[model samples]
Target: MSVARTLFRLTLLAGALSPGLAHAAGLDGSQLSLLWALPFAGLLLSIALFPIVAPEVWHHHFGKISLGWALAFLLPCALWLDPATAGGVVVHAMVDEYLPFIVLLFALYTISGGILITGNLHGSPVLNTGLLALGAACASLMGTTGAAMLLIRPLLRANDNRRHNVHVVVFFIFLVGNIGGGLTPIGDPPLFLGFLKGVSFAWTFSNMLLPVLTACLILLVVFYLLDSHYYRKEGVLPRDPTPDNARLGIQGVFNFALLAGVVGAVLMSGMWQPGLDLNVLGVKVGIQNLLRDGILLTLAGASLALTPTTLRDANEFNWGPIAEVGKLFAAIFITMAPAIAILRAGPQGDLAALVALVSSADGSPINPMYFWLTGSLSSFLDNAPTYLVFFNLASGDATQMMTEYSATLLAISAGAVFMGANSYIGNAPNFMIKAIAEQRGVPMPGFFGYMGWAWVFLFPLFVLLTLVFFR
Candidate 1:
C-alpha cells in the first residue's frame, strides 16, 4: 500500500484504540475523536518517517503541521452543535463574529499604507531603538498593524546598509506587533473582542497603561543594547547624511484623523443599548443592533474612503497579508464552529472549572496568578474565547468589583495578547511578520530559535510585569 494510505489506515486504527479520543461528548465527539486521534497519530508517525521519506516537505511544512494539530485538538470540542444547526451557526460566526475583526485589521492595514519591512540597514542603533519604542507606543493608538506599517519602511531604510540588524525586525515584532497594542481596543483584536463581550470599552485604556509603559521601557533598553552592538560591528552609516527628508513626515494627516474616528467607533461599540427604543422619522429601531453592526461597518467603509492617494502612493498594494489572514480565519471559522457551541452550552460551568484549575482568589478580588496563567493559555487557544471564558468565570457577578477590578482584568487580557508574540504560532501577526520578513530575504530564526530570543530576553520581563503589576 502507498505510504499516505498506510498512514491514514493507522490513524483510523489509533482512533479506534485510544480511549481518550473515544470519550468526547456526543455525535460531534465521536466525529472529533476519529479525526483528532488518527490524523494526529499519523502526523507523529510522519514526523518520525520524514528523514527517510520526505525531509524537504517536512522541513517547509512543519508550521502547517503544528496548526493542523491545534485544529484537530480544538475543533472536536468546539464543534458540538448538531450538523443540522451548524449552517446557521457558521453563518453567524462568519458574518457577526469574525467579520468585524477582519474589517478592523484590513482598515488598519490600508490606512497605514500597507508598508511591510524585511531588510537590514545602517544607522544610529540608539536612534533606531528609539524609533521602535516610539513605533510601539504609537501602535496602541494607531493599531499595532498600522504602527507596524508606518515604521517598517523607515526602519528598513535606516538599517539598509547592514546584515547584522535582524534583531531590529524581531524587536519590532515584539513591540509593534504585540506589546504596543495593549492600551486600547483598536490596538489589538482580542481586546476588541473583549469590548464586544461587555467588558467596558474605556476601561481597557485606563487599566492597561501601566503594563504598556512597562513593556515599552524593557523593549527600548534591550533593543538599544542589541541594536548598538550590531550597528558598531557592521559600521552601517546612513547613506544620505543630509537632514532634509530625514525627519518623520506626516504624509496624510487626514488619514490619521479618520483613524482616530475608527477608534471612537470601536469604543462606542461597548455601550450597552437595549433593543428597540429609538425612532428615526417615527420608525422604531433597535439601538443594540446599530451599535453592534452599524458602527464597525461604518468605520470599515470610512477607512477605505479616508485616503485619497494612499493606495496610489503605496504602489500595487498586494493583499498577500490580508489574503493569508482570510484563509486562516476561514479555517478557524469552520474548525472552531463546534467549539463555541460547546462553550456556550454552559459557559458558566466550564469557566468555573478553568478558573478553579488556574487561579486562587484572595478575599474580594481575584488575584493575579489566575489571571496570568489563564492569559498565558489563552495565547494558545483562541484568545477571544479564552478571554471571554475567564471574563465570564471571574466576573460572574460583575458587580462594582468587576468594574473596579477592570484595570487588573484589562492587564490580564493585555498580557495574553502581548506575550502571544513570544512564539511564532502564539498570535496571527507573529507568523505574518515572520513570513513577510523572510520573503524579503532577512533571515529570521527557526521556531525553536525564535523561542530562545523570547525566553532569554522577553519572558523574564513578562514574569516581572505579572508580579509587579498584575499580581
Candidate 2:
C-alpha cells in the first residue's frame, strides 16, 4: 500500500514536469488582456457582495462559488494558454504559495484559539486602552486573526456593562485587527505574502516600525478620549451582565510558547538558506520554507493534543471561520496569478495605464501614489492581493524593492496594513471581529455603517501618515 501510494505521488510529480513548467513563472502577460482578470474580479465581487446581496445562498454555496471562480480562471488558462503551463501554474500556486500561507494561518488560529482570558476587568478608559495595546502587540506575534479572536471576547465582557460601547469594538477592530499587524509579517496575511516573495522578515519590522507606531499611538489616544467621553456620558455603568470576583487569568498559557515557536519558525525560514530546493512544477520549494511549514503544523498539532478540548470550548472555538477562509482564499490565490503576472509585466502589459498612474515620467515610482492607491483599494478589496498587486507593480524584483524603491515598498506595506482599518471587510479579521461583537450583543454597525465610523476616525490619520511618511 505504501509503495503504491509513493508510486502514485511520484508519477504525479513526474507528469507535472514539462518544458512549459520551466517558464510557468514567466508567463507573458502582454499577450494576456484585462478580460483575463474577470474571474478574479468576479470572485472578489462574490466575496464582497454575495453575503449582503444573498446571505443564505452565499452561506450555503460559497464553496461552490469559490470553485466556480477558480475554474473560471483555470479552465480558460488551460484552453487558451499552453496546457502544460496552465497545469504548472496551478501546481506552483498551490504548492509554492497557498500551502505555506494557509498552514501558518491554520497553526496560529488553532493554537491561539486554545487560549482563553478567564476573567474580565472593568472597561475603564485606561483599562480598555491597555487591552487594545496588548492586542496590538499580540497581533504581531500571533497574527491579527489569532490576536483578535483571543482578546475580543474578553474585551466585550470588560465593556458589556457600559452603555456606549459600539465605539469600543469599532476601535478594537481598528487597532487589533489591522494597524497593529503592520510591524511584522507574522502579523498579517499581506505581509506574510511579502515575506514569501523574498522581502526579508527584518525588513518588514524595520521599515514598518515608524508608520505602525505612529498609527497605533494616535489611535490609542483617540480610543482613550472617545471611551472617556462615553464613560462620562454613561454617568454610572450598567450592572455587569456576567460579573465575577475571580482574579483574571489565562487558560492554555503554553500556547504563548507555541506562538513564539511560530515566530522562530518563520524567521528561521528566511535566514537559514540551505541552498536546496524541491523542484515541484518548476517552482523551487525551499527546504527552509518546507521545514517552517512542517514545524507550524506540528505546533498546531501539539496545541490540539496538549490543550484540553475544554479550553477550546470555553473560548467557543470552532473550525467554521478557518474552513471558510481556507476555501475562499484557495480560489483567490489561484485567480490572482494572472493579476500578479500582469502587474509584473509592467509597462508592457494591459495595466500599462495603471503602471503610469504610480510612476513618474522618468519611470521612477511615485511613493505617495503607491500609498493611496494601495490603501484605497485595500479599503475595499482584500489587502493581501492588493499589496501584491502594488508590490509587483513597483518592481517584481524583491532586492530592488528593498533598496532602490525602499520608500515605495514602505508606502505599499504601510498602506496595506494600516488602511485595512478603513472598512469592515478590508481585512479578514475585521468582519470576524464585527461578527463576534454583534453576537456578543454589541449592536455592531452594518457594512456601510462601519465605513462611516472609519471615515470619521481613520481617514485623517491616513492623511497625516501620507504627509509624514509617503510624502
- Top TM-score prediction, candidate number: 2
Candidate 1: tens digits of C-alpha lDDT, residues 1-471: 432233234334433432333223222321232233443344334434652467577655554653464345444434653322333333344444555556666666565552323223335777788778888888888777777766765666565556775787888888988888888877877787676665555677777777788878887898888877776776635454234444444455566765676566666655555545553222233565456446555654665566555443532344565655544554454455444434433324333344455444553444565456545655444566656655665564344424766644755586577767766645666656665565456787766667678788887887887677765
> Compared with the true structure, what per-residue lDDT tens digits does model 2 show for residues 261-284?
988998788667899988755667
In Å, residue 22's CA in model 2 sits off its true spot by 7.4
TM-score of each: 0.71, 0.85
Residue 432, candidate 2: Cα error in Å is 4.3
- Model 1 stretches with alpha carbons more than 4 Å out: 1-81, 85-89, 114-122, 193-202, 236-253, 272-316, 336-354, 361-366, 401-411
